[model samples]
Each structure stands twice: as structure tokens, then as C-alpha cells.
Target: VNLRSFEQAQLVGSPFIATNEKNMGGLPDRTDDPTEEIIDDLVSGRLPGVLILDPIKAGVVAAETAIKVHPIRKGKSGVPDEQGCIDMAYNCNGCGNCQRNCPNDLDLVEGVRLAKEGDFSVLSDLFDYCLGCARCEVDCMKEVSPLTLLMHAGRERIRNETFNVRVGRGPIQDTEIRNVGAPIVLGEIPGIVAIIGCASYGKEIQELYKMAEEFLIRNYIVVVSGCAAMDIGLVKDDEGKTLYDRYPGDFDRGGLVNVGSCVANPHITGAACKVANIFARRPLRGNFEEIADYILNRVGAVGVAWGAMSQKAASIAAGANGLGIPAVVGPHAAEYRRMFIGRSDDDDTWKVFNARDGTPDQLVGPAPEHLLTTAESIEQAICLVAKLAIRPADNSKGRMIKLSHWIDLERKYKGIDLPNDLEKYIRVEADIPINMKEEVHEYLKQKNWQPRDIVDPTLLKRLCRT
Candidate 1:
């Protein structure tokens, strides 16, 4: 089930799929939009059914959508985005502070005012500019939410708009698992990057294409889902090839896999779990602890949600983090005000237990520096993805190659040829790229880089036989 559109993604497998912004109704806590009828089946874990009078939208949303709300004019500057969201008793005072808070410089006030007057052109046009950070609502003194106005106008304009889209491809195929599994274990594949999130980065969606290409060219598997998948497809090269047309839709090295919609997000992590079952011959049931440990130490995967704006994006990122896979969220994600940050400077933070035996290892280096961190730029995010892909169980050759790409990306994007702290991950001469051996040797000497012991690392404390 490729999630065709958020505006009309009704499902039957409980309300789990409703976590996406597009599937924005049927939640127990959500009561403001009382107009929709809740399907008892979806709530009771039966067949997935649609929630009528959806808070997200009323009809199907399509690509290449063009809307005109009629009678365009300059709207008032002081109005809150939603007409009833603000309390008039507090007095707005016409400060226009919310406009300044927006990262994309969208005039939420004007868009709301125009929408109230039935002129949706400004609102419709501004939709591309709004990343749904809800900063306007946050910074406002009277608790005004601009996202509501955008959603309202969008629903009103797109009611009858239903475009033919290929249905969702429900799961990551077993063949894909079989094809990519061994190389991943052997380190031929440095990492699997799941690029997700909404169109919240606004007009800068091309950054996704460039970032995906950088990894794809290096033989990294790139996976995408939901609106971010659609947005990335919007960009094309001079040859008129989107990333989709350029790469095979395989879960292999250098392949591009689109799983369709946030509903398929489980498949992203499920693929990781499948690797343990299908590739390593691990027990699938009653083996979560061992499987999670394997993923953390050996899977060499990271998630990049560069334009995460909604609560659903945050929830998804947190879920991935909980499973021992690291996630890098966009700057707007910082507003969530919660992230598990690791101190790479402190040696103690990187230590892990060798669960396969009874021995303990000291300072394995920052394979995953942070479980969930924010990247301010596309370059930083790209480099972060490379850095996070370093796993405790990576072989010497794999580590060397992964480090080479990370260094290259940093040099290309941030203009620094070598990371300031590079010695922690250098296990041996082979771990350093042959070209940079001398330079790295001198650098490691200065930093007093003591080669740390890494043999059969699994973070599960219970597995230690001591």
C-alpha cells in the first residue's frame, strides 16, 4: 500500500497508520475536529477503515495540484492563522511577531486573513513555503496555530481533486532482503539510509535529490516514504531523470526503494529485523533483545528526516531511536525539545559490553554519536548519515570505506578535509584509507589515539556471562 496521499490514506490495520499527518483523524486524544465519524473497526484493531470528517482533509489530494480560492487582495497583518484559534479577549495588539518566527518567511497572518475572506490563492501559494514547524503557533503570545489555517484552506480547495496515483507497495520485498543481506553483514554496504519526512523544507526539496544521489553513487541503499518521497521525485537532472528513473527499485547497494506512505514506515525498521531473521538465521519470536543488539552493533543503518515538522515525524524518529537505529532530524525537529545526545568528547560514552563473551570493552569509539540529533544543513545531515553508519562490528575494510566517505562529504560540504576528532575510530593502519595514512598517523599521534578493543560488541548488558 504505497501511501498515495495523506488526504485520503484510509487503512484497515488498526489506527497505527493514522500517525501520519495525512491520516490525521481517529486518534483518541484528538477531539477538536468533532465533525468526523470514527470507524469502530479501526479503533478496535479490526479492518482499517476511514475516519469521516477528517481533521486533516475532506477529499483526495493529488500531485500537480493547482488551487484558486478567489478574490485575491492584501489581507490584514494582525489576524491569527485560524479564525477561532486565538482568544480575542487577550488582544492581538498587531505586533506581527509570528511572521518573524517562520524559517521560510511565510506570512501566516495574511494567508489566514485571505482564507477567511474566501481568497485562497495566497494560502494555496504559501502551502509550498510552509514546512509545518508550527513556530508561528509557538511564538505567538495568544496561542495561535497557523497550520490549522493552511490545512483548512487546503481541504476546501482540494475537495474534488483526485488524481490517479500508483498504489502503495506495502512491504520491503523478501527478495530485496535476500539480495542485500550478506553484503550488509560483510560491510560491502556501509549503510542503509532511510530518507523521510514531509515537504516542510519548502522549495529546497532538491537537497533531498542531491543528498540521495551522493549516497546512491557510493552504492548506499536509499529508501524513501510518504510526501518526502513525492517531493524528492519532483526534481530532475538535465537528462530528465529523477532518482527513481536513475536507480533500480531494489533493496540492494545503489538501489532506490520507495515504500509508499508513513504506513509502510514499519517496513523500514522491519527490514532491519528481517535481516536478523532471514540473513543471520536468528530466531524471530521472543528474541527482541538479541535482535536489537545485533542491529545496533552490526546493521550499519541510519535514518535522515531532514524536514520533520509534524508530531508524527517526531514519534517515528523516536521509535527508530528506541530500536537502536540512529536518526537525524531537521532543525525544526529541535523544537521538540527532546533528543538523546552522546558526548563524543567523553571516552566513557562510547564503551560497550561484548555480550557474546564475558569480557567488557573500553571506548569502542562513537559508532553512533547520537541516537536522535538535529542537522542544520543538508551537508551536515549528509555527513551525519555517513558518521552514524559506523557500527561496532564493522570490519576493518568496511570501517575504512565508511570513514573515507564521511571525510569526503565533510570536506566537500563543510570544507574540512578531516574531522577534527578522527583518531577514535581508527583501529589500525588498514582502518585508515591508504591515501590518508601518513596524515592520519601524524594526527593520531597528536591526539594520543590509543587503539580501542572491539571484539563481538553487543550493547545488551544481560548477555554478559560475568
Candidate 2:
């Protein structure tokens, strides 16, 4: 199959659907011809992506698909990847296209070779950001579906191995946020730190851990998912303690929340949606654009995907953008083939329309200039994360929190001087801290930054019917 053409066809709003099969006793048994089942599903246009839920059946699928399988070995008595699973990779021609196409540059050929020899440990770590987007499958010269390999590998490693795997912790619901009252007065919250995305971090992993710790200490609510969550748990501070071990795992302020695997990522965006509908009392049922506009103008949330790769990562970033939440990607994101950077100074670009009404009055100034951006380094990513979290509705304390980190990160990485036009977000002198008051005031004056009051600070307050 020409997967790119197939994806393009699907991209043009093709009505492809996903379906999970029901097996006997709630566990799918190994079928004799798993590839035939997969092909049948594909031809039926009901399987956009295949999710391997059964470990035993995963091997059957892996063998037919000719991909590496690493099902999580279950309990202490669980057996390793079966010998039949190893024999599946005998047809691989040692091509490196799959690895290059992978977001993390994981060598699937070697991984499969290792899996065939019963040593699944070598490629077990590659599952962190296995988006299952099927790009690797299309890249295979041998026409093997690589994601099925990932699922097979994951299933084997998770079900058969005796390693310490981070168990999936379902989605974060809106009621949970309401119970903690974080969404009630979101403006008072400094920022919502969404530490999400792929696990392709370099030295940035250490910096990401410190950044999360800093935000937590500064009273920002931190949320995580996918391999990013796993990476955060794996890091240790100078004192040799992981943030996951030290911090309270709550959804409240200053709490670090890991909302499970990639599929559960909607919970992060769902929390933002609830802020507009539940706390702010805006419409939500069929008003996705308006709710997203409210989030852009009012909610102080930013997504940081330091190691983003895969088409699924792109879609996640795009989804966040559509919801008015901006996402910052790491250096490796450049390999994702595109980045969306908005220019703040451009008046034409800094505008949003109220989808409810086609009137000019309901049009609002864009709260944020960019929806998705890429950082060159870890320090830059931290700075961008702090900057992206700043919204038009931020309170004085919230502005102070965001600016402090912004300036500190700028000084640490770029220079002591703040980036040009940062004063646009500084609503008042009171937003500056007492310690940096002198320096910031001097810089603002030098840049001829005028004191401008933001009247009608609500970006999407005006509502009109079409």
C-alpha cells in the first residue's frame, strides 16, 4: 500500500473508523492468520489503527506482520516472547528506513533481531512514544506494519517480562478538576504545565525534570502523559530522588498528575474545555470553536512536548492548537517535517472570530500569537513553556510567576536582557517582582515600552448569534 497516499486520502476527511474485536472470555486467542484479519479489517475501512490488547494474540499478529514483538510479560511465572515470535523477523533485510522514519530513531530491524533471539530488553525502551501512526509500516521496504511490531513488542514485554513497567493510569476526568477547584478560578493559577509528547529527549530529559520540579515548587499544576510521564518518573535529582517519588500525585495545585498513556491525552484538553464550560459557564456542547477561543483568551495552560515525533504527535499538537492551547516541541520536532509559529506583532494574524456569530463585534484579538513552536534546546523549551503559558487574563501574581521564569530562563540561556516585545504581556508594573523591579523597569524604559492598559481583557467575552 502507498501509505502516504492512503494517509492523504484519510486526511481529506476520509471516514475511516477504528473497531476493536471481541474475543472469547474477554481475551483474544492467537489466530492462525493474523495478517489476514488485519488486511480484512483494512479493506473493510473499519480499522484506522490497530490496538493490541491481548498479549497472546499479539504474537500471532506480530508473526504475520513480521514486526518485533515485546508484550509485557505478566506475573513472575510469565514466559518470555515465544520462540515463534522470534522466527517472525527472519525475513527482515536489515534495512534502516524504519529507524530513520521513527521519531526517536529506534532501530526496528535490530530490535526485531534482538527480539528473535529472546532478548527483548534491547528494544523495550522504544515503546515510550510508539504513536502507532503507521508511518513506519509504510516505510518498510518489506511491507511490514511496524506499529504492529511495536504493539507486539509492548505486549510481550509488558505481559511476559518481570520488569518494572509503569502501569497505565487511565484518563483524567473533568469532575476531578472540579473537585479540586483548580478550574473554578483558573486565572489565579500561575499556569497549567502539560508535560506531554514523545520520549526522544537528549540532555533535555534532565532539564525537563528540573523544569517540572521548578514549576511544581512555584505552585503550577503539572500534568503528564505517554513516555514523557515515564521519563519524568525515571529522572533523579542531585539528591537522588525522582519527582514522581517526591511529589504528591494529585490533580490539585502544585501536584504532578500522570494521566496514563497516549490515548488518554484528551483528558488534558478536556480539563481545558471544562474550564470554559464548567467554571466560566461558556457554551460547549456543539461550540468547540467558541470554547477553544475562551481557552485561548482565559486559560493559562501550555503544552510542552520536548521530544515530539510521529504523525500522532503532530495531530496531538494540532488538536491542542485548535483548542487554543499552544504547544512547545523540542529540537527533534523539526524532524516531524513542520512547525506552526505565529507572529505576535502581525495584527492580521493576531485575530480570532467567534464561531457563534459572523458579526465583526464578536471577533477578538488573538491572546497568543503561536499555537505550536519548536525549541532549539532544553533551556529554550523551558522559556517557551513559561512564555506560552502567559495569557491575556493572567492575574498580577500569575504574570509574576510566568515572567520570573521567563526572564530567568532567558538570562540563563540567551542573556540578561529580556526578549523583544515581552513587555506586551506585562499588564502593569505590579506584575513585576520586587527583586527584578529595578532591572525590568530599566529595560522597559530603554525599549520605550509604554504602559498600556488592557481594557475588556476578556478575549471572547462578547457573544452574538449568527
lDDT of 1 by residue, 390-433 (tens): 88788788888898988888899999868997877787677888
Give the runs in model 1 whose Cα sits over 4 Å from its true position: 1-104, 108-127, 132-167, 461-466
User: TM-score for every candidate vs. truth?
Assistant: 0.71, 0.65
Estimate candidate 1's alpha-carbon lDDT, on a 0 to 1 scale. Answer: 0.71
Error of 1 at 322 (Å): 1.4
- lDDT per residue (tens digit) for residues 441-460 in model 2: 88888878665443333334
| Candidate 2 ranges beyond 4 A from true positions | 1-186, 200-207, 238-240, 351-367, 458-466
Local accuracy by lDDT, each model: 0.71, 0.65
Deviation in Å, model 1, residue 452 alpha carbon: 3.8
| TM-score, prediction 2 | 0.65
